[model samples]
Target: MFKNIISKQLYLLSYLIRWTLISIPVSVAIGSMVALFLWLLNWAIHFRFAHTWLLYLLPVAGVIIHLLYKLYGQSAERGNNLIIDEIHQPGAGVPKRMAPLILVTTVITHLFGGSAGREGTAVQIGGSIANLFGSWFKLNEADKKIILTAGVAAGFGAVFGTPLTGTIFALEVIAIGRIQYNALLPCLIAGLVGDVTVSAWGVHHTLYHIDVTDVSGQFYGKHLPVSFLLLAKVLIASALFGLTSMAFAKAVHQVKSIALKVIRINWLIPVCGGIIIILLTFLLGKPDYLGLGVDAGYPNAITIVSSFHQGGADFFSWLWKLIYTSVTLGTGFKGGEVTPLFYIGSTLGNTLAGILNAPVSLFAALGFIAVFAGATNTPLACTLMGIELFGGEYALFFAVACFTAYFFSGEGGIYAAQRVAAAKTDDNYLKKIFSKYRP
Candidate 1:
């Protein structure tokens, strides 16, 4: 027994050493290159060409995307789906043409003010690059998956500068109930290396600012009643927030289905959506809600938060954003939905926080996690992200709100291909559809 234990320990130690030696430097180099490309891409798109209205150039944008898709065929249509496909099928790596095509299309989308996020574009680039390495190295099927996961972590870490969260995301996102433990070391290495490289290049991230109170502080003791009440409010808020998020996701999916059914042209969906966005912008008299809504974070900006006390942000601010983002993403715009969810959540959370007389900072934090949990169906990841971004002071409240949101959000999510390993209820179709695919 002693000999077997000693041999097992030695084997584990050797594996760890080998992985560390291989992963660190490789991740660092790959991360640095990806960061540089993304930095250049963002600046060029935002400054050089963002002024171009989507309505004016949307036809051309449609032409380009259609041409690319027609050229690449169905493989191009599988952008992020390619990642999920690769995980399910080993010999499949993302096509070499994917990176350039996505980069070009995404740049065009952003430059023309198509509502979108940048992280999806970066992840495609990073994953495609790592796919090349796996193919060249003739890595085994398992290692191929590992490298792809590491690539995702690297890309997310580089963009967000949250290595730990990125690492967890890579591991947790592969499937709902199962995690690939073998992918952990590689993801950690890639995430850490990517964040370090991005920071070294002077890229900065927005930190969530909140006041922390000690567990035993006099103020906390006095505020205990309020805190408990706030927790209850958060739970209620998160439930409603989850329903809103799920509605947005399902609405986009439904629109895409309708577009595909009604417009057999296939290429006109995004163009039509773009036209609607333009019409909405004219009708609403504000373009602030048209894009990714990052400007919401700016001081004195026309954000939902700023207008909360003044009777909410222009009735359609949130709804317009939801429509633009949904159409932009669902109709094949290349970007992430996570950032937009944050925007929506913050807007809604801030409004409720004001009504309940809760701290804005606390509500903002809750909003961040609750929306994220609902959108991604990643309650645990959102909980950890809250703790990491908001400090440990509100861990209890954060966890409660996150899970509540997740439950209310149900089986639907931003990622349609996400596997449902287990369900809280046997009545749902999640069990029927996903039981066969659980890995």
Candidate 2:
């Protein structure tokens, strides 16, 4: 019995060792590609700003992007959703062309001042690279899934510089309220390697700070560490953040449907979107709602960093960002929604802190991760992200905001391919009622 047990343990160790080795190269490739993409993205943003007149050519750029995709994108146009679908149910596999198509088109979108993010583009690069590697090695279906998960981990980790969050996100993102432990080891290895590789390329992620000096208040004749009032405020703000996430998701889908219905020609959809964006920019009197919204290197510019201070963002800034991103992505622009979501959440949180009389930075930090958690249906991952980005000084509050946002955000998410493995809330009665009416 002892000899048999030892042999079984040795086989398991060998299996893990093999996968770990495979994940290293996969993650290194992903991280290197993401670094290159980020470098180009930064260049495009600066170039567009340098020549503000380029904004007027956005419609033309959109038309070109549309034609290019229609001609050669094929199933690659599905983007992150396609990767998610393959992970859930292995199919034709992620196309190799997806990486280049998304990279070039995303840069074009940013170059012309489109409101979008880079997560989707990086993820596509990672997934495409991993799938190609898997095919080269003739990996079976099960191993293919693990390889894809590792790719996602590498992409997310490298882009955002959060390996733990990236690992959990890759495992949790495929199914709502479910995690694939089978791929945990590979995902961890990939996330760590990817983050390290990106850093090795001299890339740096944005920094955020949260002040907790006044987070403590006396309560009920005892000196409590954290203020009860602050917790209450966090709960309320997180609920609003969740609702905003739902609104953004619904609006994106609705706008896409309306655009397709109104426009007979597919390519013209982005043209109209570009025109509308220009009009909105003129009306708003500033181009703050465009591009990544991380930083623009201009004083008093509304950005994720600016939203952490007082009087940095205006009321309804989040709403405007939601509209801009919805229209840009709805009209078939090539980019991700995460950076925009961060802008929306932080700005909205800044506004709420003014109303609630809470610490602006703390609330902004909470909204930053909570809204993403709600939108992506990955509360645990987002909670970890909060800790990674803002430190663990307010971990309990982070958990509260993230979990609450996840609950209130409803079933809709940015990734339609994500499956509902478990019901978030008890709906047995609703399910029974609907079942009785089924044909």
Candidate 3:
């Protein structure tokens, strides 16, 4: 029995060591590619802002992007969903061309003032790179899935500068209530290595701060720092955040369906979308809703950074961003929804703080991670992300907000390929909710 136990332990240790060795090069490649993508994204955003006239040619740019995909990007067009599906059902390997295809299209989308995010591009790059390496090594299907998971971890960690959260996210995101523990080691190694590699290239992520001093005061004779009232406000705002996530997901699906039905010419769909976005920009009298919405360094810019302060964002800022992003992506634009979701959640949280008379930065921070948790149905990952992005001073509040939002966000998510390994509620209740949204 002792020899058997030792043999099993040695086998496990050998397995871990082998995968760790493989993950090093995979993470390094993903990190380097993501760093380049981010650098180009920043340049594209700045160039668009400087020109300002590029917005007028959005439709033309849209047409060219449409042709690029229509001609040679059919497989790559599936984006992150393709990666998730491949992990779940390991079919033909992820394509090699996905990397350049998404990188160029996403940059073009941003260059022409399309409202989108960089996460999708980075993730596709990682998946493509991993798939290429897997094919080169002649990996089996099971090993291919594991490498793909590691690729996702590398991309997410490098892009957001959150290695632990990225590891958990790659594990948690495939199924609704289950995690792929088998990939944990490789994912962790890849996430950490990817983040470090990106930093080595002089790439930096955005910064966010929360003032915990006032909110940490004792209340009602309890030693706890967070107040009951603040917790209550978090609950209320988080529910709204969840509902908004559902709405965004539903809107994207509905818009795509409607656009496809209403338009006969496939290529003209994005052109029409570009025209609508341009008209909306003129109507709104500002371009704040365009691009990444992280920070434009311009006065009166409404962005994720702006949402942390009073009067930094308008009450309807979140709604407009939702509409803009949904339309931009639904009409066949290339980009991720995570950053735009951050914009929506933070801005909505900022609006709610004024109504609840709570701390603006505190609630914005809660909504930041909570909405993402709800949208992705990964509360644990989002909670860790909150602690990673902000400090752990408000971890309890982060947990409360993230878990609540996850419950309220419903069965649907931004990734339709994600399956329900376990239901959040009883069968009857979940069935009722699904029925309402089904048709």
Candidate with top lDDT is 2
In candidate 1, which residue pairs clash? none
Model 2 lDDT per residue over 107-201, tens place: 99999999999989988998999999999878999999999999999999999999999999999999997999999999999999999999999
In model 2, how large is the Cα lDDT of residue 69? Answer: 93
**TM per model?**
0.87, 0.97, 0.96
After superposing candidate 2, which stretches have Cα over 4 Å from the reference?
429-439
- Per-model lDDT: 0.71, 0.93, 0.91
Q: For all the candidates, what are their Cα RMSDs to the real structure? A: 5.1, 2.6, 2.8
lDDT of 1 by residue, 1-439 (tens): 9999999999999988866765676577657766666665566445523454545665567567777778774575666657756865765568777667777777667666677776776677667777877787677888888888888888777776778877877777767766778888888888888888878887766665664533232353464423555666777888977887787779778877888888887777777877776777688766666545554423455553453333434444456667778877777666677767777777777667767766666776687678878877777777877887777778887888888888888787877767777663566676788888989
Candidate 1, 36: how far from true, in Å? 3.1
- In candidate 2, list every pair of residues with a backbone clash: none
Which candidate do you rate higher for TM-score, 2 or 3? 2
Winner on TM-score between 1 and 3 is: 3
| lDDT-better candidate, 1 vs 2 | 2
- Candidate 2 TM-score, C-alpha based: 0.97
| Model 1 clashing-pair count | 0
For candidate 1, the per-residue lDDT at 135 reads 81
